[model samples]
Target: MNRGRQLFGTDGIRGIAGEFPLDPASVYAFGRALGRWLKQQTDQPRVLLGMDTRESSPTLVMQVAAGLRREQARPIFAGVITTPGVAWLTRTMGFDAGVVVSASHNPYRDNGLKVFGPDGFKLPDQAEQELEGAILELRQAEPQPLTQLEPLAPQSSLTDAYLEWLYSHGPQLDGMKIVVDAGHGAASQLAPRLLTELGATVHSIGCEPDGRNINAGYGALFPERAQQEVLQTGAQLGVSFDGDGDRAIFTCSTGRIVDGDAVLWLCARWYLEEGWIANPARVVVGTVMSNFALEKALAERGIRLVRAPVGDKYVLEEMLRHGAILGGEPSGHVIFLRLATTGDGLLTLLQVLRRVAATGDDLATLVRDYRPYPQHLINVRFQNRPQLDNNPAIQSVVEQAERKLAGRGRLVVRVSGTEPVVRIMVEAESEQLAVSTCEEVANAIRSAIESG
Candidate 1:
C-alpha cells in the first residue's frame, strides 16, 4: 500500500472516498488500528461513530465499525449527526473515543475521518502519529477478507436525546426573524428545528441534501446566498453553516458579513459583561489568518488577542494553554470551550443570537464600528518544493516589506499545509500597500522556484 501520508491531515484522514486512504481496505485497517489502540488503553472500549449526510459516509462507517468489531470494541452508531455532536456525545456518554465520518466543508465527492478523544477534543499529535504507525503495520500484515458489515440501527432515541440537550441549554428566541442555510450537510435537520423550538421565525435554505450537493455553492463558503435570502425575506440576520456543521458564517440585516472575528469579539464582550468569563483580559485566541484590526480592537477592550497557527485545533490548543474561553478562526470555527468541546455551528449561532437578544443591538450596529484592516493573500502554486525562508532573495524582499510597514502592519509567508503552493499574506493600513507588499514577496518566491 502506498503510504503517502500513512493517511492523515490537519483534521483527519481526508480524501476522495474510494481512493487510497478512504478505500475499503485502508478504512478497515484504520478501524482495526483505532480499535486495537482503544483495547490497549482499556479492556472493552466502546466507540461512538457519527456521520454526516454524504452518500459514501454510511459505507465507510460500516467498514470502520466492522474493523472495530473485529478487535472486540463495540461501535455505537449516531447516524446523520454533526461533528461536534459526535465529540460531545463521546465525552458525555463516556465512550473511549468518537469518530466522525464526514469531511467538514469539502465537496460531496470527498469524505474524511476525524477522531475525538473521550474529552471531546481532537487527538493530540502523539496519539495521531501512533495511530498512523499502527495502521501501516496492519497494512503490511496478512490481508483480511472484507465482510458484509451492517451498522446497528434504531437511531431515533439517540437523535432525540441530542435535540433535547440542545433545546434545554439554549434560550428562547421569542420573536426573532432569522435565515439559516444548512449547506445541505449534517445540520440540515437540526438547525431549523432548534431555531423554531426557540420561537424564532426561521427561513431555511440549502437544507435539502440529495447525496451529491452537500457544499455545492452553499454554506459558509458562499454567504452571498444567505445574504440574498435574508434581504428577500426581511430577516433580522442570516447564518450559513458548512458541511458537517462545525463552522458558520453570518450576514447582518444590512448585508454585512459577520465572520468568526466578529463573532468572537461579540461573544467575548458578552461573556465578560454577563460574568461568564472571570478574566476578561486573560486571552482570546485566533489563527494567523485573523485580522490585525481585531487584535487592536480587543486590545482596547482589555483583552489580548493571541495568534495561533492556521487551524482550529491549534486555536484550541492555545485556548487551553492560556485558559481562554473564546477562540475561533476567520473561516467561522468558534470554540466556546465552556459550552461545547469542539466548534459547533449551531452552538455558535445560538450564542451570537443570545448576545443580540440580550444587548438589544441590531446585527449591523454590533459590527459597524469594528472594521477589518486591509489584507491580501496570494497562493503561488509551484512544481517543486523549496525552502522559502532560507532563500536569500526571498528574505531580502520580506525584510524590505517589514521595514516599509514598520509598526503599521505585518506579513506572513508560509507553504500551504494541504496543497502544493506557498501562501503570501500582508496586512496594512491601506489595501494598495497590502496588495503591493504581498505581491513583492510572492514574486520573490515565484522567481526562486522557477529558476531552480
Candidate 2:
C-alpha cells in the first residue's frame, strides 16, 4: 500500500465503495488497529460506532465491529446517526473513542471513517499518524482468521441520547413554520423527527434516502431547490443539511440563501446581546472566503474576526486556540464550540430560529446587517494546477487588476485543494466590475498555464 495515498485527506479516510481505502478488508484492518490502540490506552475500552444512511454503512459497521471484538474492545452501535452525534455521544457517555461511518456530504456510493477522541474532538494529528502506522504494519503481517474473530452484539439508542440532549439545551421551535432539506442522507432520519418534536410546523424535502441519491443536487451544495420550496410554501425559514449532516445552509422567507458567514454573524450578535458571550474580547473565527462585510460588522461591535484556513476543522482549531465561542466556514458548517464539538446543522438552524423569535425581526431584516459586496468566482479546469503567480505574465496582470480596482475591491486566485481546478475570485463595488475583473484574471491564468 502507498500508505499516505491509500486513505486519509484533510478530514479522514474516504473514497468510493470497493476502492482501495474504502475496501472492506482495509476498513476491517483500520478497525482492528484502532481497537489495539484503544486497548493500549485503557483496559476493556469501549468505543461508540455510528453511521449515516449510506447503503454501504451497515456492512462496513459490521466489519469494523468485528475488528474491535478481535482486539477485546467493546463496540456500542449507534445506528443511523449523524457524524456530530457520534462525537457528542462519545464525549457524553465517556467512551474511550467514537467511530462514524460516513462520507460527509459526498455521494452515497462513497463512504468514510472518522474517529473522535474521548473529548469529542477529532483525533490529534500525532494520534492519527500512530494509528495509520499500526494499521499499515498490521496489513503487512499475517492476516487474522475470520472464524477466530469475535463479534459483539450491536447496541442502539445512541441517537436517543443525542436527541434528548438536543431537546434539553436547544431552543424550542414552537409556532415556527420550518422546512428541512435533509439531502436524503444521515439527517433524513433525525432532522424531521427533531423539528416536529420541538413543535415546529415542519415541511420536509429530500427526507427520503434511497441508498444512492444522498447529496445529489438537493442539499447545501444545491440550495436553489430548498430556496424555491421556502418561497413557494411561504415558510418562515428553510434549512438544508449535507449528506452526513455535518453542514447546513439556510434560506429566508424571501428565498435568499444565508450562508455560514451570515449565520455566524447573526448568532454572534445574538450571543453578545444576551450576555451568553460575556468576554469583551470575544472573537468570531472565519475563513478567507467570508465576506469582508462580516469583519467590518464584527469590528464595529468590538468583536474580533480571526481568519483561519478553508476547512471547518481548521476554523474549530483556531476557535479552540483563542477560546472563541463561535466559528465557521462559508460552506455553512457553523460551530458553537460551547454546544458541540463539531458542526451541528440542526442545532444551528434551531439557534437561528430562536434568535428570530426572541427579537421579533424577520429573517431578512436580521441578516441585512451586512451587505455583501458584489463578488464573482470562476473555476478553470487544468490538467495540472499551474503556478500562476510565479509566471511574470500572470503576476503582471494580477498586479494591474489590483491597481485598477485600488482599495474598492479585492482579488484572490488559487488552485482548489479538493479538485483539479484553479479558482479566481473578485469582489468589487459593482457587480459588473466584479464580473469583468474575474473574467480578465481567469483569461490571464489560462494563458499562463498553457504557456508554462
Candidate 3:
C-alpha cells in the first residue's frame, strides 16, 4: 500500500489506463472504498455510475459494480453518459452519490473517476481527503477475493430521466439552428438526440465515438474543427463539448471561436435583461484566465465580475460565496449554478441557444460587443514548481512587465496544478505586445528556476 496521502488529484484519481492508480485492482479498491463510505451514511445506499465512451470504461464499470455489491450498496448503471448527466441524475433520482469514469478533455488512453454528492456537487476538498484516508486505511488491511461478493444487476434508464429534466427545467430551443460537436465522447450519443428533440435543427460532427476516438483531434479542447463545421454547415452557432461533456466551447457562424469568457458575458447580459438572475448587480464568477474584456464588458452593464482561481471548483465557490448564479472558466467550463452544480456543456449550450432564439439575433451579432482582448500565454516546463513570489528575480521581471503594460494590459503568472509548468500570460492592446511580453516573462521564469 502507498503511504501518506494517496494519489487523488484536484478532480479525482486519474491516470493512463492500465497504469498505476487507474489499474483494475486500484479502481476496484476505489469502488469498494466509495461504496463503504456511502454504506456508512445509510443502509442499502444507492449510487449512479456513468462513464464516457472510452475503450476501457466497460472494464472499470464492471469492477466498480462488483466493488459496490461487495459493500452491499446498490449500483445503478447509466451506461456511457456525460458527467453532468450523472450529477443531475444523482440529485433527481435521490442517489447517495454519483460516479463518473471519464477524464474530461484528456486523451482516450487516459481515464478518471469523479464522485459527486447527492446535491450534484463535486466532493468538497475535505471530503476527498477523508475518502483518500479511508482508501489508504483499507489498503493496509487484507484484500478480499472477488468471488466472495454477490452478483450485482445493472439497472439502466437514468438517461431518459436526465433528458426529461433538460426539457422541463430550462427554456426550449425551438426553431433554432445549432451545431453540436460531442468530441466523440460521452455526449456523442445523447447531446444530438436531446437537442433535436428540443426542436432545434442540429448539425453534428465528432458524434461517432469508437472509444479510441474520444477527444481525438476534436472537442472543446480543439474548437477549430467545430468552428469549420459550423461555417460549412451554415449553422447559426456551434457548441464543442469535452470528453465527458462537462465543458463547452462555442463558435460563431463565421467560424470564429467564442470561449468561456465571452460565453459567460453573453449569458450575463441575457440574464440581466430578462431578470432571470435575482442579483441586481448581475454578479458572475470567472477565473484569472478570463480576458480583461469580460470584466470591462460586465462593468459597463453595472455588473460585478468576481475573479476566482483557474478551476471550476473555485469559480463555483466564489459564485456560492457571493450569491451569484453564473460562473465558468476561460477553457469553456461554464457553470449555471442555478441549474446544475458543476459545469454542464450541454446545459450551457442549451442556455446560449435559448438566448439566441429569444433575442432573434445571430450568435455572432449577440457577442460582437464582447470581443476578447488579444491574450498571449506561454508555458515554461520546470523540474519542480517554485514559489514565484519568493523568487526576487522573477518578481522583478513581472513588475517590470506590469509597469510596461500599465493601464493598457494585464499580466498573470502561476504554476499549473495538473502539470509541472509555469504559465505566463499577458493581455494587451495589441497582440504583438502580448506575445513579446509573455516571452520575456517566460524567459525570466525559466532562468530563475534554472539558476535555483
Which candidate's lDDT is highest?
Answer: 1
Cα lDDT computed for each candidate against the true fold: 0.87, 0.83, 0.84
Which lDDT tens digits does candidate 3 get at residues 114-137? Answer: 999998898888777777777656
Q: What is the C-alpha lDDT profile of model 1 across 282-340, one tens digit per residue?
A: 68999898999899888887789999887788899999888888899988999999888
Runs in model 3 lying further than 4 Å from the true structure: 1-6, 142-156, 169-176, 280-282, 447-452
TM agreement with the true structure for every prediction: 0.93, 0.90, 0.92
Better of 1 and 2 by lDDT: 1
Give candidate 2 misplaced runs (Cα > 4 Å): 1-6, 142-154, 379-406, 414-423, 439-452
Better of 1 and 3 by lDDT: 1
Clashes of each: 0, 0, 0
